[model samples]
Target chain A: MAGIQKNISPTHIDILKEVGNIGAGNAATALAQLINKKITMRVPEVNIMSFDEIIDVVGGPENMVAGIYLRFMGGIDGNILFIIPYRNTLNLLDIIFGEKKRDLFCEFDPIERSALAEIGNILAGSYLSAISSLTKMLLKPSVPALAIDMAGAILSVPLTYYGHVGDTALLIDTVFEEGENLIKGHFFLIPDVDGYDNLFLALGGV
Target chain B: MDVVKVGMADLKIVKNPQIITTLGLGSCVGVVLYDPEKKLAGLAHIMLPDSNNSKDNTNKAKFADTAIPYMIDLMLKKGAKKERLISKIAGGAQMFDFKGKSDIMKIGVRNIKAVKENLHKFNINIVAEDVGGNYGRTIEFNTNTGKLTIRSLGKGTKEI
Candidate 1:
């Protein structure tokens, strides 16, 4: 497990701080379309630490969540992590799209999937494009997977995120307001070496 | 071709141009079933893996175990054949940082499991599935062609 290095890796942290600042800014741009309103995203709180540290602060196991994980390849290759609590997702959507007569997450409706996907898509694209400008690689993004809940499930594998600073997980706090709803969306940057390396392979650069 | 929205735990059936849809999936599961011959497709979004654990029907769509059975029964009542029917599913993303410590909200994994169980109970197989990840998936089903398209953020649209 790589711990945070203050002396030897200040440069790495600096680069990531810039990365996150831009990523959050871009995410706000994407949200503007769906909600039809301007989004305000604050500068993300960043840290560099091991996986165990993540489990400590990220609520608890039973927390229902929504997330988008994308593998950036070549020009800008890494993990782009984004998440929000389930209840907040609906509340945020309701705010952006106006009051829904039905539950924002009415299970049988797939329309919300598109709405959420659009949000994730634009954020990832914006983040990658920013990174690509720096890395000079054509950043390609993968699909967004939104997990509805985690009741009655088993831990089968270790998951890594690449949405952080200086080899550490990057954490962000996003604020969304459309109408009467003000919702917060949290973003994480986990370092997924496997996914990153996969991108290298995809472009025949691996 | 009327539009019917299915609630979390509930089921809806329609004939001739009926559009049934759902909103955000996050880690929840979307189960879409359609019979080409009958031109009937029913979509259910279930939260948890099983309803046996929940005594309340309110969260029916939140759990796969309960929602799968509930959806299948609804289809049966609408005169869809068990063997003639096939299913398509999407949405299951790991949304939070667990640091691999606990599988608490592996809801995506459990949702898939419950869909499998309930489908098995009725002898129906999932023809296709788009699942797992840090990304959210959106699915659209056209009963006319019985085609389901899954759109993942940044991943583009894929027909399963």
Candidate 2:
């Protein structure tokens, strides 16, 4: 574990960033098609940080968000989390259902929750497929699970999985934007510790 | 009056007039050991059930098995008697309703169980607890009153 951390060169970060670029690019395309709107993405940021810092990246522990989680197994092992702020979730629902009900504290009905889950499924599928094709690794994503709650709580689930091996986690993060609506969402790709070695090796790393 | 924030996989001990807090506990458990008479409290935001599960266990506060004992030792050094300490725990919620049969999905339950077992091993009685749900919780422990205040989104705030 120490060896992997010590050996993460700048080139490795760049590789991970490029991986994020491809995966999120494909995901952005799917999201754009689903909402029938133009979408833009920021350059992916690859960070190695502690569990607490990771929570702050998603808007602190108390920030309310609609989080979609999935675990991938097979060629690589890791978790993918797609998080949209609570307000953005309502905005997304408005766009998908073609309605203007923008209640701040409105409850998400069963259908609305399912719709969000399906969106997560499609986006994550595209994202995983992009990575799989890039590395020629067979990555199978589990069913998407949705949780609408505090960012800290939702993020803890994934961090705990990584915490077994190390105190810090390396993540590739991407942000998506919608032009007029200003709706935004974040994607966090966290590969397990062993998966990193395989990923780096598959990308021709020593 | 000052709130000392405890980060994830971290621990802190405070004396009177100070409140200790940990935010966004999902599957993680926030264990608070308080000595009301001494007016001292220690809080640990434990992430995993056991330190032995990991190859690297340098961070003692990251696991229930290691964190509880470590905090107890620190409290004892600061004049908190083991007999006077009472436990109040929060967080350890299955934040998502995952349908898959993955072991990680049951992590919240496992964490809660492990925390209980560790506390039992220390012969500390848990006075109050607000745990086990599909929600995230942020908790604050008051050293002066030995009150654990738990806050959750849409679930309101309550003291356990």
Docking quality band of candidate 1, CAPRI definitions: incorrect
lDDT of each: 0.56, 0.91
**Which digits, one per residue and each the tens of the lDDT, describe model 2 over residues A1-206?**
36338679888998899989999999999999999899999999998888888888989999999999999987789989999999889889888887775556567899999999999999999999999999999999999999999999999998887788788899899999999855799988999988877888889876
Clashing pairs in 2: B1-B17
Give the CA lDDT, 0 to 100, for residue A153 in model 1.
13
Off by over 4 Å in 2: A1-4, A100-103
| Alpha-carbon shift of residue A122 in model 2 (angstroms) | 0.2
Measured with DockQ on alpha carbons, how good is candidate 2?
0.81
Model 1: residues with Cα > 4 Å off, grouped in runs: A2-8, A55-58, A95-97, A101-108, A150-181, A193-206, B1-160
- Backbone clash pairs in model 2 (N, Cα, C under 3 Å; residues 3+ apart or in different chains), count: 1
Candidate 1 achieves a global lDDT of 0.56
Reference interface contacts recovered per candidate: 0.01, 0.83
- The DockQ values of the predictions, listed in order, are 0.02, 0.81
